[model samples]
Target: MEDIPNYVAATFIAIVIAVLGFIYYAVNTATPGKKNLTSSLVVTILVGWIFFVCVQTFNGYFTNLSGIPRLPMFVGLTIVSIIILFIWPRTRAILMEMPITTLHYIHIVRVPVEMVLWWLAVSRAIPMDMTFEGSNLDIISGISAPFAAVFMVGSRSKSRIGATIWNLIALALLYNIVKTAIGYMPYYFTPTGGEVANLGVFYFPYVLLPTFIVPAVLFSHLVSLYQLIFKKDQPQF
Candidate 1:
């Protein structure tokens, strides 16, 4: 909070606008009966805002990995998960009626979570390795990022492959920009370093891109393309 001037006020205003905008979008685009856009918009904003303002607050440093403020995050997620459980007819019907597959679950969580993370990345609160500590945490994405790609390919969907591939390629391009901003790699690493650990290298997260995030994004889209070709846009009843 100290890092921000009047953090609470700024946060409140930002949230209000976002909520209003979401409501407008939902009201304008929601289908007539299936799920009211108004309601969906409310739920989405509630869940999303809670995650943004309460749950995932540590300035976006995933490595801060601390545990003090995660309750809001968990609670918001629980609420949203419950809503998904109830509203998604096909997925809901599957339970005993059938069974929702891992892929189904993935879409429910991944889509929102990734979108949020992306937003945070854009917001400096998350930091783009603007500092040493930040770069380190950012690197974690290097390993975990690829899982997104793996999931895309493994899902075996065809119709959506093109979209996913497009997304992956976009991520790669964005990652390079971020890496450069961080002063890592050929772009700039080791702003200062000595006695680097054996393999003790530390260009920090900025330089770790080749490691995780790059490929995950790349793979997700590639997988999407595959789906576009050989699979259905969504699951069959």
Candidate 2:
């Protein structure tokens, strides 16, 4: 019974990954050249996560937050994934071609993610600051996503501009939450005995946030920004 919340959180994390994976598949398969790459990226994410769980690697690392504070493995994965998505011509093309509305709709997952984080916070699993009731304002982006997709996603200049502005706001919100999270961690330069520690996030299911969900969200936003900038001439329809 004590572990029920963990199970629930894990389930949500799985759903997040599954939904994002579906989007990735849809985007990749929408075009001729993007198919094979999906399997490889999916495999890499899963295998990397499997290794983390099997080794319980993060637990040890978190203890000495000053030594090398960040969850290097997951951070590396996210950075590499983002780099590939942005720098590789094939992936960049696929990202640019992915529907902006799809990207907006994908943010809806952040709403439930915020709920789960609040649940975890109430359980004392993580800091309150990570929740919407606290410093995390990312929920606004999620709650507004569907509306933005519906009303602000036309080929019209105003619509495109609206989407671009929304993306920028969402990016700022994400950055805030991320910085707040890291500050609460037992990391270098952070004072000891903060009001709430971020230990829970390093656990099995929660680790999925930094490893998978956050990265996916970042990728989506980046793709949106790229499309809004370089691909503006192409109609979103």
Candidate 3:
């Protein structure tokens, strides 16, 4: 096995920190009083990520480990993110209050994220199926986000219908990539057996995908949907 380089890991770690920092800034706008909790959330997520890296890479628990239906770490992180966005009272409220336009901008992270995945694929760290050329069409969502943010969100045009449709489409794209990723894992329930094992995801930086970015991006899509549907604050140009 090729030893992972420090620069690759360091660059990804920096991206993760930047993404979380942006999230904190965006979220703080809505829940000013939750500063302590927000800070704690950042700390907790970083700590959790460090622990996951240590376990999977340093401790060697996930090296060639197989037979599990799903990576428990991935599933656990996704589940916790769902609960935080949908079930937690204060957190849910803050998410709901977030400006729909900002939600659209947040998804721009997916663009760089997709590029990073492609780089990993080029390095043979992950499968090509997870990249733009394959089944993962999630980059479409990222590319279209800014346009949607401008036309649908900023203008507050009479295009609520268009906005709603865009969100649904982006959400579906996200779901597709997530489903494909899970199915390609090295597990008993995996849909296929091939040379490509999703071993890259278990390492540092990439682990942040399941732990931080995907969940956060997923939550962003969900909350945007909630705001579009439940709340009637659609801005009009």
Candidate 4:
């Protein structure tokens, strides 16, 4: 629940995507048979996203976490990437299972989704001021939609649903950002303290909704994984 810059959100997501992509590209491009492209990309992007979050939080005030540095965190995660891909069994197994199309679709979702969310916040259509209330409904989809992908049934069509939703949200976010940039969008809520209360870094419930998005992703994935393990034939979509 700290003050976060819009650029930080976008840039952090970029960093996450870049790192994840690098790993996927390395493993999938080089290793054969084991690689599943979509999951690899999602993992790669999520790892990079951690860096984005770290920097955003450490750089901000009011949290009293100022002593912590940003670059070091990124460095650590970088090492983590190496270890995860090269040494960790769980990591290796997950990466090997990733599909090429899924990887492609994940990147498609995260980057634009973050951008779309920020654009809405900036436009004041969403509560850019970082309060827990008065957020735009469009902003909600930006977080929740890509999140649904995390819980996919691992069917071939999984990527399709995520990608379509991402595109729709991204376009909406783009439109919102443009509207804000033109000075027409309304800013309904501005926190007096400039603090995004109760939300995690670069996060706001009304604006970001971690509980909604993150939980949805986890629960969805868990259920999907369960079905896959239990011999159910749920379609990926």
Q: List pairs with backbone clashes in candidate 3.
A: 156-235
Candidates' RMSD to native: 12.8, 3.4, 3.3, 13.1
The Cα local distance difference test for each model comes to: 0.35, 0.72, 0.73, 0.41
On lDDT, the leading prediction is 3
Q: Residue 206, candidate 2: how far off, in angstroms?
A: 0.1
Tens-digit lDDT string for candidate 2 (1-237): 254365666767666666556565647554656556765675576666656653664455534456555575557767796887688887677777777777777888888888888888888767787898899999999999888878887443347788889999999998999898777775533444756677666775666677667777887788878887888576552
* Model 3 vs. true fold: TM: 0.82
Model 2 per-residue lDDT at 42: 57
Write one digit per residue (lDDT tens) for candidate 1, span 96-211: 22111222222222233233333333432333342223332333333333453345433543224434553555455445544544343222233343211111011122212222
Off by over 4 Å in 4: 1-62, 70-82, 111-114, 120-237
Better of 2 and 4 by TM-score: 2
Ranking by lDDT: 3, 2, 4, 1
Candidate 2, TM-score vs. the true structure? 0.82
Position 18, candidate 2: lDDT: 67
